[model samples]
Target: MANSTALHSNITQVSVDSNKNIESLRMAYLILLVLCFCIFLYFLTIILSVYFTTAHIRENTRYVLFVYMLINDTLYLVLGFFLVVFNIYVINLPVPLCIVLVILSLTSFMATPYYLAVMSLERYVAICYPLRHAQLCTPQRSHAAIAIIWAVGFSPCVADFIALSSSVETKYFSLSGICGRPMLIKTPMQNNMRYITIIFSFTMVGLIIVYTYIRIMLIARKLSSNKSSAFKAGKTVILHAFQLLLCMSAFTSHFTETYLKDYFAFFPITNFLLLMCLPRFLSPFIYGIRDEVLRKYIIKWHSFAITLG
Candidate 1:
């Protein structure tokens, strides 16, 4: 009888300890999520303030694309954060709501590479056809391009939604599940379509970046007077390719998490931050600090803020 009581007490202690450990882990993840979100928000606010307050930055086609990229990334991050939170808490959300969130998240996510491609092309035109750059990259054209990008980004999501609507019963939308792409994207057709779209988009963007980089390199070699500008543009196109690669890594994250799950339990969170969030976080610094014109205004704004503080 005494041994039975002792065994019961030991079991209770172990259970309590396990609960404590899980709670601690939950708190740590929560803190990490908040820290990352806050940091991105701070930098985004500063860069956006600079963009909005400066007339030239707002009007310039290149800057306009940069701003759109920033906004698109922000939207992606916000939805991603929410989805991560919901997944962590195992929150069962209405299927319709989850569908909307997933669609928006995916659209914004896909838009990044398209934006990068356009930005590279803009640089290519500026260097290869300097005289006609102004006519080719007008503010109106940039705005129209943004609209087209949105449409392109939404294409895959729309196709997925249509597929879902046809096969899924109305009762399923009324029911709740943990908000995620896997919850909605169940059909084999949806999976195949997703893979094809991703491959095609990445392939196209990669080719565009590669082509621009090569052209810029050729231009840099030929022109002594404009060599410096052409060289810088080539480097920028390379960075865009790097950024596109980072975005593409996100699609492989499922495999990554699966392979690493035994070794690292928090692999998903790490993957989300590194693969999903880090590229976007680096955007402001990559373009804002690297560009001479934007850097000049960013410096002035930083000094002004410091002085005010």
Candidate 2:
């Protein structure tokens, strides 16, 4: 009897220790999430403020597209953060509300690569056809392009909703559940659509980026007078390609989680932070710091703010 009681005591102690460790890890994850979000939010505010207040920046087609990307990323980040929190807390949300949130999230997610491709094309035009760049890339045209991007991004969401409506009962939309893609996308048709759309979009964007890079590089080598500008544009396109790859990796996150689950129990959190969050987090820095005009204005505004502080 004494031996059995001792064994029970040891088992109880182990269970308590395990619970404490899990709670500690959860707290740490939450702290990191909040910290990263705050930092990104702060930088986004500064960048967007600069774009909004400056007439020249707002008028330029490149800056206009950049600002739109920033806005889209902000939406994605906010939605993603909320969804992560909801999942962490195991909160049940209204099915309709969750569907709306997921739709917006997916739309914003799809828009990123499209925006990057457009931005690369802009650079390509600016360098490959410098004489026509001004006429080709006006603010009005940029705005129209943005509208087209939104339409394209939301196309998948529309199709998915239709499939969902047909596959599930009317009451399904009325029920409450955890808000996530997996929770809502419950049909084989939805899965196939997702895979097909992702593959097509990524492949097309990859081809566009690669084409632009090669053309810009060839142009850079040919003309001595325009060599510097062409080289700079080539480098910019290369960065865009890198960013696109980062965004693409988010699609493979499920595979990463599946393979590494046993080896690293916190792989989901790690994968989310690294794949989804990090790409958006790096955007402002990649474009803002590298673009000479924006970099100059950012520094000036930063200094002025520091003086006032």
TM-score of every candidate:
0.94, 0.96
lDDT of each: 0.90, 0.89
Write the residue-wise lDDT of candidate 2 on 196-221 in tens digits.
99999999999999999999999888
TM-score of 1: 0.94
lDDT of candidate 1 over 1-309, digit per residue (tens): 999999999999999997788668767876887797787777677788888988888889999999889999999998998898888778899998999999999999999999999999999999999999999999999999999999999999999999999988878889998999999976899999999999999999999999999999999999979789899999999999999989988988999887987776566777888899989988988887899998887778778888999
The 10 consecutive residues of candidate 2 with the worst lDDT sum are: 263-272
- How accurate locally is residue 51 in candidate 1, as Cα lDDT from 0 to 100? 87
Q: After superposition, how far is residue 216 of candidate 2 from its true place, in Å?
A: 0.6
lDDT against true structure, model 1: 0.90
Judging by TM-score against the true structure, name the best candidate.
2
**Candidate 1: misplaced stretches above 4 Å?**
1-12
